[model samples]
Structures are given as C-alpha cells and as structure tokens.
Target: MTKSHDVSVQDFNDEDSNVSSNPTFESVLNARLSRRNILRGSIGSMATAVLGTSVLSACGGGNDEPAPGPVPQFTPIEKLSFAAVAKSLEDKVTVPVGYTASVIYALGDPLRAATADYKNDGTDADFENRAGDHHDGMEWFGLGADGKASLTSVDRGLLAMNHEATTDEKLSSFFLHADGGKSTLPRPAAEVDKEVNIHGISVVEVKKAADGKWSYTKDSAFNFRLTPWSDVELSGPLRGHALAKTKYSPTAVKTRGTINNCGTGKSPWGSFLTGEENWVGYFARGAADDAARGDKSVVALKRYSSVQGGASRHGWETAGTEDKYQRFNNSKTGASADGSDDYRNELNTFGYIVEIDAYDKTKAAKKRSALGRFAHESAVFGKAEAGKPLAVYMGDDSRGEYIYKFVSEAVWDAADASPASRIAAGDKYLDKGKLYVAKFNADGKGQWIELAMSNTAIAAYAAYKFADQADICVNTRLAADAVGATKMDRPEWCSVNPKNGEVYYALTNNSARRVDATGSQVTVDSANPRAYSDVHKAKSSPQLGNSHGHILRLKEDAAGAAATGFSWDVYLFGAEADASTSNINLSNLTGDQDFSSPDGLAFSPSTGICWIQTDDGAYTDVTNCMMLAGLPGAVGDGAKKTLSYTKADGSKLDVDTYVGKAPAADTLKRFLVGSIACEITGLAETPDGKALFVNIQHPGETTAMANIANPSKYTSQWPSNAGYGAGKRPRSATIVITKNDGGRIGS
Candidate 1:
C-alpha cells in the first residue's frame, strides 16, 4: 500500500490515542533532551503506564549536539536501467527481461557424495547430509584453493545460508508428524530426528564458470551442515553463567546446537553470525513447571513467551522420554538441584547469536550471549575505524519490541579484517561489549540508552529485580523496560547504507496498534503514527492497524556507528497503488512499484542499491510476495506530509509526520515475484554486484493438513516446475540471478 492507497482519514478513537494538541509538536521537539522525555517518547504509553521514573543515570547524557564525520563514496547509478518485472500470483519465479534466474540448491538436496539423491518424498533418510528447508538469510565468501575463505576470487565462493524452518506438514509431507498433528504420546522418532537435523545452517561451495554459469559443487569438501544435533560451545558474556548450565554440559560452557536460525551476517573476520528467532515456541514447559521457579524467572520467560506450562510447537518432546527428545521440555523434572538434571535451562541456551566458522568445519560454532538475547532479526556491523570500537546494530522482530546495538570494548584494527583466526577475533571483541536500546525522540533525533545493571535506575526497576550483570544480560527485555526503550511495530531485518552508514529497518505490519476493547494495544506514537482501516479481502472486520508497514532510517551523530545520538525519519510508507487515499501511501507507489509488509532488506555494498522483499498476507489475493530493487537517498530526503481521511463518524483526523520523496520507476522498481503461498526473503549479492541470490521460502505452505494425500491440492509447484526439478511437491530453494551480458546487476 502506498501513501495514496486510501482516501479516508485515519480513525484514532482508540483509548490510547494521544492525538491531543496539549503539547504541540514544537513544544515536544524543542523540549530538553532529558532522560524523562526520552523514556516517555521512546516507550510511548508503556513507560508512563509502567515505570514512574525514567532517568537511568546521567552517564549516557542526551547531548543533542550533532557530530560530523567523513562522507562515503557511493557508486552512482544515474544511468542504470532494467525492465521492471510485473507482479504475478503464478506458481513460478519471475525476473526482469534481461536477467535470468536459476535454482542453485534446494531443501533435501544431497550435500555429500555419500548420500543418495533427495526423492522430494517423505521417505528420504539422510537429512544429516541434505539441504535444510526454508532457506533464509545468506552470504557469499570468496574461496581459496585450499577450500578456505579468500578476500578475492569472486568466481569461486562459499555460500552460507540459514535453513530457518520447515513448511506446513501437508505441503511437503516430509518429516512432519503423521496425520499432521502433534502427538500426545511417543511420536515417530525417525521423523522427529529428520525434522531436527534439517534446521540451522548450510555451507556449500559454488563456482561461476567462464561463461557466467553458476553451479554448486556437490562433492566439495567445504560443504557442511550445522543442524540442531550438532555440538556447539557457549561464548561471550553468558558463556560461563549459571543460567547456561544444562545436563549435557554441566560446565555451562557448551550447548547442543542452534535452532530457528533466521537472518544472518558475514563478519569482517570471515565468520558467520546466525540469528536465533522464534526459538521459545520450540520448547515445552510442564503443566506444573511454574512451581519450580521464582517469580522473576517466570516473568523473564513470559516476556520472551517461554512461560511454564506452554506446549511445544511440534511436540518434539513427545517423541520419547529419552534425553534426546525430552530436552525440548523446559519443565523441572529432575531430582537433582539447579534443574541441571533436566532441560529447564535449555531454552536460555538457544536464543543467542551463534557464530560459525564456515571456512573451518573442524571448529565448533559458539553461541555469543553477550549480544543480549531476544528475537534477533539480524546483526549488521558498522564501519570499523582504526582506534575506534566496532558497533553492531540489531532489531527484535516482534510487535511493540525494541531496537538494540552492541559496542565492542576493544578498539578495531584494520588488520583484523583479514585475521589469522576469526574465532579469536570474535573472542577479543564480541566477548566484551555494552548493549544499548534506542530512544527515538520527537525532534527527528534518537538516543542510544545503555542497558546495564550499573545504571541505578535499572537496578531499582520494580518490574523485574536485577541481580547482576548476567541477570541483566539474560533478561535483556527487562533492562530495556527499565531504561524505557522505544517499542516498534515488529522491527525486522536492518541494513546499513554502505554509502553513508545510515541504518534502515523494516517494521513489518502490526494489527494491534490501537487501544482495543481487550486492552491489548500499542498506542500510536511519533515513529509509528498511523492507525486506520486497511480492510483487504476479509471484510467481516476492518483491519484497523498499520497494515502496510513503513521503513525507518537513522543517521548516526557524526556518521559514526558508536554515536549515542542520531537523526531519524520514516523513509517510505507501504500502501496499495490504486487506493483512494492521499499520503497514506507516502511513496506514491503505482501498480508497478507497489508492495506490503517489507521484510527482507539489503543494501548492495558495491552498487549502493537497496533491495526490498515482501512477506505479505494483506495483498496475497491480488499478488504474491515479491522483491524490489530501490535506489534510496540519504535520510531527511523529503518533507513532512500530513494526511487526512474521514472516519466512520464523518469526522476527519490528520496524521502529520516526515515522509520520503515519492518513488518513481527509476528509483524503485519491482524485480521478482515468488511462487504462491511463499515469502520472498534472504537476499545477497556477490561483492562485484554481478550475481544476486534470492531465497524463496515455504512455497505451497498454506496447504491444509487434510490435503496431504493430494499433490494436486498444493498451491504451488515452484522450482520443481520452474525448470529446476521435476517433483510435484514445492521446495524452498535459492535462485541465483545474473545479467545476460555479464555486467553488474541493475546496471
């Protein structure tokens, strides 16, 4: 949806609406940049309704003075051109006229010569040697002759991608429980094992021949898989913490593996950072589990939705009473003290950023807990200047969540970018850092409030008692609450503009922004100021929420990643192209450039081009999920636009805020569309910008369990019928796109 999609004024009659004119815009903007105002504005109603005091300490002051820094040399694209692909709901991949896309590898494909070919059927048994399902964030690293990461050699590279999760059981009929339902008793162990082994990350070698043709080397020694069954170590702040202790690792220094690995990043020292998201749902707590823990423990779990008595998503624990399957149970069941005899502490070990050495298969991946755990969308590092500490930006992917950043304590050395050991580099930096939450003020400025028990305010917070550094780090959300961090509308993947170091985030749609009758509302605020009816196909009830989410950009003070203060604005607003509204679709999108629920986002380092991908439920009836290429300008590129629409009472209300310059075909254009019932996510480009890799996830995911026996009932038969394979079932896969003339993409 674009700014002009709807003609009606926004309806803000909800109880939490702060649309009053009492404190005018100017008053709010010019007010002293104090911790109190920072807390109020950033947390919106959550802070006022909860925390009575806001000033954490004056340590991290609100210095509004702007800092200056060096400007980046962005590659110009004024003469670049490419035919925009038309939107489609077809069960196949579509690309621009001059660009061609081919499947590189897919779910269940064999990654080793010893394994048999994938049948695309439910009976394949070599999951340990096969590609995992639901391909997500990925990266390309140049490969050396010794099968290690090389700074150069773009033609031959190692591709590391995350296998986030599997599709609905009915869609693939692969490894899902029989009857497509959770079992109350022992489940089929073989199926459970396969499902567990198909998650985590996949590192495979790919090479582009002289003719520009790309192919994955099936027998490459560099090919490896890190699944839920793999052994991994714990590192950083929480490495030796008591909370990380489990039966499998009484030393509290190791864990089994990573799960639900989503968005990822390629580190400067040549390692992979895989984010763990939606991991709590995979663990189950017994019915009487709450009796075994303290109130603070329960509160922390509930904050992350890992409460006691919760049933696991797939009932993995029901597979058997053995430790292997029972580890999914977070309930207190052991006779031993500290809950180490059971898996109560298991959930805490899974939600951190896992660091992997894709170039060294012999090394074990480490879960870095010092980064602060939450539903991590992804972690993108900022420019590392010599003698300055490095900064890592991240977002929590949930409605009404907060944004965070971690600043390394050690100063950066350019030589470390090509270090002798990436793991050692990680230990020197990621092991010691300060985690901070964002506080976006009304004057287009933001503050990075530190989340530390050292702050008296955090220690005194009544919501959850803080014990020590580990407590604050383990329960990061509570620390954020005490500091009054800004609650966003489901902050997702973030990208740092390579040209200027500005950070951009995709706040996917939120259907619960207004004060609801049930009292579960996220009040509209300056950053998220819209609440209206976006009613799509289902008209039984008005979709009174932020249906078409927006992209927010921030410029660090002085253009430094570690700057505590910054400027910000909404870069673009999503809405329907032909809607009868004005300014609602701030980008002024037409059918050719329209999209919703912008999820996956990436800025090409070489071309300075921003790629936007969608995971939409609002526009699926009209078009399937898609990806678009955009050339974005710096922050504050447009003016404040106030939009109005008539409400049901015939009264008109206005939404006043900054909006980006209207996008045109040349600036923002559709690039590709995925199969039906699919989400287009996880994009990466070769450093030279010659080839682009896009992930198509969960095609035909909406198929009902009752339709499992009928392949004809599936909504999509994607890469299989798209010239990559010949199976009736749809599988998630990675597609490599390139220009026919062997030139830079989007050129």
Candidate 2:
C-alpha cells in the first residue's frame, strides 16, 4: 500500500512538508456572515436538526432556497439485523450468513461480441474491447431502450468504472522471464500495448434477470473501453494556454488519454468525472530538464515531485519511438520552436478531472482544466440551488496536501436538467469556475481561500510569480501553499450526505507529522491530532506517524455551496481495538466497528447510510481490509473528548476534539472482508438500494513478479474459490452483493 502509480510516490512510506498558516479565525468568520443575513436561530441546533444535508443545503434565506416549507429530517435506517461477519485471513470473499456475493465482472472480460473469451493464460490480446485491471471508483447510469436517462431503470443500465492501475506480472506473460528477470530492457510491443490499454475507464452495459441476478451484457452496443489510446479534448481556461502546446497538439486544445484514474464522481448533468490521480509517475523526465527550465521551474517541479531525471514504474519510455510510446517521455528531445517537435509538454496535459459522456460514444472526453490540477481523488458535488452557482468539492490525495472547492460561474437552470447531451451542459458550467483552497483554523471554523491570479496575496508571493489565471490553476499546490491553506493527511474520497447535505472526507494514514528535537517536523494541529507508533511488518523499527487515520465533517455557511466560511469537526478517529491507549480510540469503537486506513467512502443517496471501506497495511496482520455499513448521526451528536496515547519511549500525547457517538453493533457492522493483500474500494448501488456493487482490487498483490507464473505460490485465490475455478491467477474484480431473501441491502 506504500507504493502507487506515480513518481512522487507519496504513499504510506512517503512524506511531505511545507504547510502554511491560516488567516485570523474571527476575520474569516465575520467576512463569511457579512455576505448574508445573520441567522436568527441557534447555529448548532439548526445544524443538528438537518444533519444529513450538506452545509450548503440546510441553510435558509438565500435567493436559491426553495419556497417556504418544512425542511425534512433524514429518516435513518430503522434496524440492522444481519450479523457482522468475522475477520478472516482466508483467500476468499466472506459475507454475512444470509447474504450472497458473486463476481459480476473480472479483468479481461470481453465487452464486445466479436471478442473471444479471456483465456486466463496471459495470451489474449483484444484489450481494447476487454475489461481492465485494478477497478477503483464507479457509478451506475440508468439507461432505457430509447437510450435516454431514467433514474429507476434498474433492469437495464450502463456502468462507468475507472481502472486505476495495471498488474504488471499477472496481466502479461514473459515480462518476468525476459532479460533474466530484469525489466529494464526494452519491453515487447505486445506486452506494453496490453498494459497501456488496460489502465483507463470501462463503460459496460448490465442487465438484471427475473431472479434478480446481475450480469454484464457482452457485445452490447453501449459497451466500450476508453484506453490510453483514446482521443480526449481539452476545455476551459487553460485549453489554449502556451504551456499546454506540444507536438501532439500544436493548438493546445487536445490530448491523448486519461491515466491513473482513481476516485470518480458523476456530474449533475449526467456525465462521468474521472479524476487523474498519481499521473505524475507515468511520465519520465530528462536528466537535464531542471537546467533547461531554470531555478523557478525547478522549484515548482519539486513541489509536485516531478523529478528531472526520474523514470516511470512501467518503463513506458523504452517501449518505442512511436508518438504513442514517446509521449510518456517528458524530456526535451527535439530541437524546434516552442517545443512543437517533441512531447516535452505531454505531462502537463494530465492531472485533471476528465468528463466523459457515457451515453454518447460519438463525442470525445473533455479534460476540464478549470477545476485546478493536483493529485485529485474524488470530485463530489454539493447541493445545487435553482438559481445559485454549483459547487464541487475535491481533495488532493497526497501526504500533507490541501482540500479544494470549485464554484461555477454560470447559475443553475432547470431547463438544462435533461439536455440532449450532458457534455453540452458541462461546457456551460464546468468550463468556467473559480477554484479555492481550504484554510482550517483551531476554533473549528474554516475558510475557502480563492486561488485566483487577482488575489493580492497570491500575486505578491515571491516563490513563483503569478502570471495569470491559467498559471495559478496549473500550479495549484504552490498557490495553496502561498495562501496558507490547511495541510491535511492524504485527503481521499469525499461524499456529501444526500439527506442533509453534510460533507465527509477520508484522510488516509500519514507517516509524517511528528515533532523533532529542533521542531523541524510538522507539529500537531487541530485537524492532524494523532502522532504515534504502529507496528509495520516490513521494518523492525516502529512506524511513527498517524497510522490509523481519521474522518472529518464540514458545514458550509448559509449561502450554501459558494459560501466562503464553514464549520468543521472530527467525526471519527480510526484505531484498532488494542491500541496503545484508550484515548487514541476516540470514537470508543468496539470489535465490529474498528478499522484503519479508511480510504473509500460513500453515502447512499436514497438511504443516507454511509459506507466505509479500508485500504490498509497498518493492521492487516490482525485482519484483512474490510467494508462496514454505518448509520451516521449529526455532526455534534457526541460531546468533546480528549485522545491520549503513550509513545514507546514513555512520552504521552493528548488531543481535545468533538467526537461522534460511540457506535454499537446495530448501528455499525462489518459487511464484508476481502481476500489476502487486497483493497476493498469503489462502491455503488441502484436507485432501489436492492443491490450493492463493490470492487476487489489487486488480490495477491504480495506475489513477487518472479514467481507470477506459479498459481500455487499466489498469496490469494479469490473469486477462484468464490467461482472462477482452479489454476487461475488472482484477478481484481467487481462483486455484486444482495440479500438472499430479495430484501433491500443493509437493512
């Protein structure tokens, strides 16, 4: 889990520094309230009454607010009666006794009729029409016979799934035996092509049978794959910027494809927004790039961890001299005016939120650069008011990164809700917006600081001179630093409660944030409170950092999504049952609810039940990564508590914060446990909530590339035991979960 797709590699083993301070608490709060009428009611009580709605959706008196009516309270799940499944180390998918889990789709499954079945012998080659590896984030789009959107069409629909990364050893043959087990040499063309084509999004059609079973519709007209070879256009403010110009697109309006797509979100206009996270590691930089760009460019490159002479994990540069392969090389290899003869500018084309119209295969995907570039995880939408601007919340998924928000310039119009093309509506709103980074304070309040070129602080910063709006958007991390945004601990997936509109984010483990004798390390802040030790099996030394991460909740100002000020609190502190101290387990979690490295988070749109999935290496020795279903209460449902933990050296650490109520077995229960060395991620449910879809990524990941040929040596054989049969290598897949009695899931 410490390793990832890109060069920066800020996984569990990596760390970053350079967090700035926030503005005075009183000033930001006062300025936020000044823009709107002060609430006549108690803020805390009002926040409690409408707990499930996000910060922006619960407030009143705004022009976009609905006509006077009682604000509905979220109807919580009455009772969870299914028994919690026990944690297991067996290489099989385990669920409650009354539930059934089956593999719906697996790697290399053909999406088209002409394609042959996957041989599972590593010799199949129709990757362009087959499923991909490492399925991450996904969404279900309802489709009718007329090819129109329908919210309740559960029997027929399209699923847009993101293939985050590829499996080097399992997916290809002979890559391990070539060059005497060394992959440094030039890889075979076929092997490289297979890997490249398997690292994007897959749009497939699925249908439910009369028995309520789900299966992929192979060869359906709506099924297709968007691989690294797909052509995608650039839209928004930076589309024609000089920095984006290259040999591939001299006019700077187009790019090749999307890579490292991790977490994803569906747009309000019905398009899919797949985030390009960890794309930096996919490009190789020339050794002399730093000298050619000068000192300023080097500083910016270092901030993003774009090493001047670094090589990618897949060695894609050694594949060939063809433009398709050479685009992976970011070196200035050609001698032409404006670098038009080379692919030096190719890396800049990535690290963005790409929009795809799944219903229309004729249109090219658009990379909306106005959303601001960083290591984006998920781009979740806040509540959209009728006449107000739409707001999108996103997190930069790297250690010690900041959270960001994008406010569209155009106001929401009811007429565009069911447009002929969702991509057309995206051009109207997503292409023009203002991007802001968050600045959290010690007093449980935060502000969204604008990262525009016109901001006085940003323009005056000496580190990197601000040229224009495009410049600021490209170097978002640097602008965030200059504006004094709060540095978080690897902010991952974000979800807005549909019932109340409250927002929640998962801050994965941070192996940094300890205080040194000289005070050079990142100190404890109100947000990043815990700094302790957790045992790591790889090293003899204890891991000194926030191994068990936490979850955060936010409530925006009365003006809703576009509001500048918001209130925040720590919702849950992730810890094991046997942590060094009781205080570290601030939520007072019991056996059924405890977990670490909370990675994938999603709230049921129809039921308001929050689903938490773990991608952990911290406590895997005790239990494999798992998924839990929870009925989340309001932000202030519990009283303030202090978390204290003692270090190995006997020194004690304590943190004071507002924690959620301790959960019982009935409120929070383990739903599923994955196979060995796998991450449980990418959850979705149909509108009726009768079926739940979850992805199992990289099973048997601990298998070394040298021993990939032997199935018996594999660390995991999941889906094999769950159905796929024997003598098969462990493959990542999406499994469908349903109650045996045909009842609604999680009830």
Could you estimate the TM-score for every candidate?
0.88, 0.89
Off by over 4 Å in 1: 1-74, 169-185, 515-518, 538-540, 580-583, 643-655
Give the top-scoring candidate (lDDT): 2
lDDT of 1 by residue, 554-666 (tens): 88898485788988888878777765345356677877778888888888877888888888877776778998888888889888766554444455545466777777778
Q: Report how far residue 558 has shifted in candidate 2, in Å.
A: 0.9
Q: How much is 575 displaced in model 1, in angstroms?
A: 1.1
Clashes of 2: 11
Stretch of 10 with least lDDT, candidate 2 = 47-56
Give the best candidate by TM-score: 2
